[model samples]
Target: MSQITTTCPWVTNDPLYQQYHNKVWGRPVYDDRELFAKLCLDGQQAGLSWLTILKRQANYEELFFDFNPQEIALMTQDDVERLLLDTRIIRNRAKINSIIGNAKAYLAYSQNGANSFSQLLWSFVGGQPVINHFNVMAEVPAQTPESQAMSKALKKLGFNFVGPTICYAFMQAVGMVNDHLTSCPCYLESSAKK
Candidate 1:
């Protein structure tokens, strides 16, 4: 018989989603570029499922110059119009523009001090993951005080589509907070890191 897998119930049986859940989601990401990319992808998930954004991630990378903030920051209205027509990625004009706008904001934010974008974000959690032991999916929250503060801060910096809910999802996705159920094998591993 197939080995029974224990993980967050949100994970579907699809190979792509499974891979993301088992290997990538809730895994701490310290790289600045990777963090920026994740933030933008989470923004794209505003009105859709995370799986939908994940499926088109490669296309996003290709079309958005591998999510290079410097390059994307330079994208103009013409580029937005063109990208809105591309079927490979989400065709929402506002969503597309938000990515570009966020890049510019990220670049500016990164210039503040010794900290990179990753450092700035992780600092909110005191440079470590806040591990929570939820027993079920219902216990998982859509937003938290930290996420609310993060959303406000990001908005102050000119980033869009970064409401509390989206910020919470970003936090979970980047492993800034471990929302994995206690019984899940990944929980122990995730909660251990600083």
Candidate 2:
């Protein structure tokens, strides 16, 4: 089968971006570790480009205990201090703190029988993907009411760095919503899946 190059300019041309685009970008990720990674990365990407965070993902994994919420939740102030000095990923103090804080919140949620981050997130969409038939990148929305509601709920549940825009990006990353342009190959491929 022939591949349709992505219509999203950010995903075109670059091999790494293209690989992520074709494989993981719009794919449903249910693993807790992966969900945490996406949430952390999306939060870190708040003031930066997605490509920037994508490039530093390996570093993030190394520094953040493989995005394991339980492990990250146990991190101490010394650990935060150590991460602050690392130049491999974004060195922002607030971002670093948010990662640790979010991990703690994740653990709390799990303890309360939330169980899976994927389950909690996907529930907002009724366990179905919000398929947007966008013909152009501009037609894609930055934030939706679903995201707004999610952001509010997450904050209420103690998660930080989870504003509406960031939540929307998280939703896109984890495939709770497929923002792929209609002409893109993965759009149809993703929609065709159960």
Candidate 3:
């Protein structure tokens, strides 16, 4: 008899995506650099599937200074143009520019006394992850009020490509919220951790 492996239905058998779903996605990350990187990667997923971006994430890390805001802020137009030719990442110019732009905005926020990108982001959930039990995938929403507020705040802070929908995905990805389907084996584990 063939045994079954249960996970979020959206996750396929691809190792990269499977690893992301099982080991990374829905796991809380509080590091400033990690949060910043996830936000930029989620932005790049706009109009594209997350799988498309996942395949190129290592390239993004290699090119984007591991998502360090200061280094990304220093990237020039020439750097972006050069990156556009690389196939290892999504070559969209607008997305590339948004990453550079968001890095600058992130730095400005981080420079505030006792403030950090992680703090700013975690503030949306009031320093706790919003745990939700959704029995089915359809029950999950595309955006929540918290995410809408986050998007507004990010835009006001001069970040781009951070719409409410994208913010919700970012939230789900980084464990600002627990969105695993209730029946998935990972749901309780994801909710229990961080």
Give the count of colliding residue pairs in each prediction.
0, 0, 0
TM-scores, all models, native as reference = 0.95, 0.94, 0.95
lDDT: worst 10-residue window of model 3: 1-10
Candidate 3 clashing pairs? none
Q: List the residue pairs that clash in candidate 2.
A: none
* Per-residue lDDT over 139-169 for candidate 1, one digit per residue giving the tens place of the 0 to 100 score: 9999999899999989999999999999999
Residue-level error in angstroms, candidate 1, position 160: 0.7
- Any idea what lDDT model 2 has? 0.85
For every candidate, C-alpha RMSD to the true structure in Å: 1.9, 1.9, 2.3
lDDT of 2 by residue, 40-105 (tens): 889999888888888899999998888988889889999888988998989888899999999998
Local distance difference test scores for all models: 0.90, 0.85, 0.90
Return the lDDT, model 3, position 69: 84
lDDT of 3: 0.90
How does residue 84 of candidate 1 score in lDDT?
88
Q: Tens digits of per-residue lDDT for model 3 on 44-122?
A: 9999999999988889999999898889999999999999999999899999999999999988887877577788899
